[model samples]
Target: MTPITRSTAQLYETDFVAWTEKTVQLIRAGQFEKNDKSELLLSGKSGNKRF
Candidate 1:
């Protein structure tokens, strides 16, 4: 198989933000888990700490 080159990889990387947003949307829609550690790390409104 042919290797993915730097330019091709860069193109994908440029669209990564949009990809991540779509993934999160899918997770929220119950399609899958978000796998979002940052969201888990944020403090809740009641000041509860989350791991």
Candidate 2:
């Protein structure tokens, strides 16, 4: 069996704005499968807190 190698992206660290926009767009477009976080990583979830 061949092992699959996947490349990782650091969008959240490199460009947070772009990451947020992309995440929002994916949600609005109903592309849930494309979202990195299954729950959308909303505030209070995935360790994200609102300040």
Candidate 3:
């Protein structure tokens, strides 16, 4: 298997502002849960789940 690289991992880590913007967009688009409970339940373990 190919070894993981720092650049590859770093690409997945977005800055705070970018992350916040994307999350807001998703919420507004109705792509994410509307309620806190539903959101928590649907949240992923890591960034991988978000993708």
Candidate 4:
């Protein structure tokens, strides 16, 4: 099976502002399914401010 890849994965690492903009846009547009759930969940687990 193919892994669920995140389009914003690199942005999350390189550009915090861009990543946040994209994520907020995705959420506001109700594109919840397109979000990187695994990444967010992992961030939540780690209590990361960057996520």
Report the number of clashing residue pairs per model: 0, 0, 0, 0
Worst 10 residues of 3 by lDDT: 34-43
Please state the error at residue 17 of candidate 4 in Å: 1.1
Q: What is the lDDT of residue 25 in candidate 4?
A: 93
Cα RMSD for predicted model 1: 6.7
Residues 1-51 of candidate 4 have per-residue lDDT tens digits of 875468667656668777778878998999988877655643465586433
lDDT of 1 by residue, 1-51 (tens): 999999989999978777788867886898755555454444678785765
* Per-model root-mean-square deviation over C-alphas: 6.7, 8.5, 8.3, 9.3
Q: Candidate 1, residue 46: CA error in Å?
A: 27
Clashes of 2: 0
For model 4 the local lDDT of residue 12 reads 62
lDDT of 4 at 17: 70
Worst 10 residues of 2 by lDDT: 3-12
Which tens-of-lDDT digit does each residue in 1-51 have in candidate 2?
Answer: 865444324543557678778988998999977888644544664687432
Give the lDDT ranking, best first: 1, 4, 2, 3
Clash count for candidate 1 is 0
> Which has the higher lDDT value, candidate number 1 or candidate number 4?
1
Can you list the residue pairs that collide in candidate 3?
none
Task: Please give, for residues 1-51, the per-residue lDDT of candidate 3 as tens digits.
Answer: 998799866766656456667777877898865423322334456533322
Model 1 error, position 43 (Å): 16
The best candidate in terms of lDDT = 1
